[model samples]
Target: MKHTYAPIGLYSLCKPLLFRIPPEKAHKLSLRALGLAGSLPPARYVLKRFFSPDTQSLSLFGHTFINRIGMAAGYDKNAQALDGLEGMGFGHIEVGTITPKPQKGNPNPRVHRLPQESALVNRLGFPNDGLDIIAKRIESYCNRRNKRYSGPRPILGINIGKNKTTANAQAYLDYKECFTRLKDVADYITINVSSPNTPNLRALQSEEELEKILTPILDIRQKSASHVPILVKLSPNLEHNTRTGMIQKLVEWSVDGVILSNTTKTSHPWEGGKSGAPLHDATLSLIQETRSRFPNLVIIASGGIGLDGDLQTFIEAGADLIQIWTALVYRGPYLLRRL
Candidate 1:
């Protein structure tokens, strides 16, 4: 297929305007635009042709990803922007840190930009449209069929979390419900137990607590006719022994993958977890150590990825795949092409 290139310096020219909007508002606006373009046939065609990256594929978890870069969760917590984002050349789009029920998340001004740092600190919690609606949205989008569009389809993963109102002991029920509801639609499922903003959520990262959580989910996966990969997302702030202990539990349960190093609380003075250029070194270290200890484990690296060099660094560090959230915000959609 012939491609129509976007005009040079398009995002550079638009960066100032995007920066002028409040971070959360600008995020919603961009998702709306992408959703609109993705919903319309002509616009979808133009987008796919213009932004599709050169095919660089890999196989994992019994699926082939067209590229190594994925859009991390929280960017499209409701799955509203998959088509446009997929068109923009991401190998996969992981949506939601979804809970059992809808939530308002934290108040406004929860997402802050550190332009000089090329980073973002977010305390948005896990606000989303809940399991039922989000699952349906994904199902409807998947039902559209990939044949209508060119290029390999991007893999879809759903990240699940507990509602803020749920107690730590009851959190497994929330995760189980989300997994039971979303598994059919999701290519993979990520259990998010590491978001710093969620009260006591990170406590679930403990081996004992994680076993309570993963047991039921793994039981269900065992019973189901289909096997969907289940991954755990770990906080970047974990001490060495704590992190490795968690991984040992994961191995014991035979979980499919691990997303190393979510946003960090120590990297900046901000009140929330930070992601961007500052996160690269710590994340890379996590990837290296985790890879060394668990040679065969599938590791998805997130945090602090921006340039092509960062991509190479993660890959060299033994990351099976890399995810971009803050970098996408800083560099624009064109970042995918550059990667």
Candidate 2:
């Protein structure tokens, strides 16, 4: 007798049908399906076999991840579907670019797909269910850890961002709020300052501003009885020198890790931030430059990683871990399994 895995095939067949709908709607539907499928024991086992990676373990920031492959933030905005995602073989799942308060985000049509380029453009503005809600969800998920599951639990990385409407001067407060709430449950925290959708958000990446924001956050983390690792997400569009300087600042601040290159805002042939194939060069360059300067820093490469070759490039470029969101959208869950 032979066993068959049909969901991936079915998903490939149904993708065109899903694509006919709005991109965001398709995304929500996919997420819903993942959540439902994960809840089912038999289906989850099949998915784990098909998508999960059997690889050597990795140690970073004092925690061990099942594998180097992780789901980038923005997929599970409210931390709702982590178990489902883990069931699909992601070693680490980063949820949310969450804010202190609930926000509606930019508007409809914020997420656009470019099938020709196998990429996506999103200006979601970090809309989330707020830090309090996200914290509760994570706590609940952790509480259910004793329950049986198909595979090992995935590491949870919570990515925090300022609310779109929040004032820049008050941004630290928002980040602190989320950190305080999610610290106990999150395996790590990613301080996101790279998204281009929010007004004046990227400005925080500057040395002067970043110092002010990070100093207090770092203090809070140090003072806490439970210490959680912190990583900062950087933009790929910044000049190489600027990116290097940011890395240096991160090292000086004693940040635990760095996510090299978020979505690129440069729109050459495609709209939105150029991801996938287009971002490979810039992302690789940034990673290499940062690695050269800060060899000890934990580097999680994010941009342009869609294939094994791209993953190899990042690893060679000195990345400690790798993440993919656009690739998962373009290539489906099989990419995780393959990696």
Candidate 3:
């Protein structure tokens, strides 16, 4: 069995100091540390040995996931930390909210930490290195690892979104471009229509607008020799009827899966979406409702998953997979093995 002990010693010592820095800067620093460690073979091995989860394997979408846990999309937005993150024991590492063109996201002081709530409110509007550069990064990362390590590595999921400059009518072009460019390197692709920071991006969740986005993408999927599972990340604040209607449309279109939620729009004294403990109830409710309604649809539950109890509760509520972001901020890498 996997160890349940949370390794908090060093992280506890470092948390306060790290927290003292601005959230986004701290985030970049953390990823840079891991990226540096990953670039060295000996360091990568040691990190992997210490942090890797020993869990039963799961097969989904023609790939093997070594564990149920994945690092969610927004954290590694540019795909820069894949090797280091994989070394730290996530069964999957999702990157991006990447757009067709490189763009600066929301301005600084965008990501705020709520230490007491263990939550984050970010309007970091999909800041990324764009599709072309990130795709090469992923491709290069996979190539380097394939040549060096023969053991299991984390599954790569590329999450794509439209550029801020793109109008709602032309959004499908951006998604199509990203899907086409990224399909080769990705084990799966997630369509991000749910981030509250992006204006009118959530508007695509409407059945009519969504069909516009999916039709061409599905056509490409059918024609391509390779198959990549496509998933949609949704907002937690979606109304009952709207959410259900969207899922039903996803089913009809034969989309592969759905990420139960992104974050909540309940950011008070802030302008972005809220994540962490506050999102747990909504995520759980969405997973149960979706599972009960569509027994076979793949459900990747994200939001408010930090503790061991939260992990178990989500799975029990019918989450086929779980992704973590805020939890990593609050609890550190040790939370992976603890779960």
Q: Which candidate gets the maximum TM-score versus the true structure?
A: 3
lDDT of each: 0.86, 0.80, 0.88
**Rank by TM-score (best first):** 3, 1, 2
lDDT of 2: 0.80
> Candidate 3's residue-wise lDDT over 273-301, tens digit each?
88887777767888998899999999999
Error of 2 at 62 (Å): 0.6
- lDDT score of residue 88 within candidate 2: 84
The numbered model that scores best in lDDT is 3
Off by over 4 Å in 2: 1-11, 149-152, 266-272
Rank list by lDDT? 3, 1, 2
Give per-residue CA lDDT, model 1, range 102-198, as digits (tens): 9998887788988877878999988899888888988888877455655468899999999999999999999999999988888999999999989
Q: Of the pair 1 and 2, which is ahead by lDDT?
A: 1
> lDDT of candidate 1 vs native?
0.86
User: For residues 1-339, could you state the per-residue lDDT of candidate 2 as single tens digits?
Assistant: 111122244458766787799988988888888887777878888888887777668788888888888898889998777668978878789999889989998878778877766667887788889888888888877776546644556889999999887899988888878887888788899999999878888888888877877888888888888789999998877776777787788888888988977887855443355556556666777788778878798999887677655566688899999898877776678776554
Q: Ten consecutive residues with minimal summed lDDT in candidate 2? A: 1-10
lDDT value for model 3 = 0.88
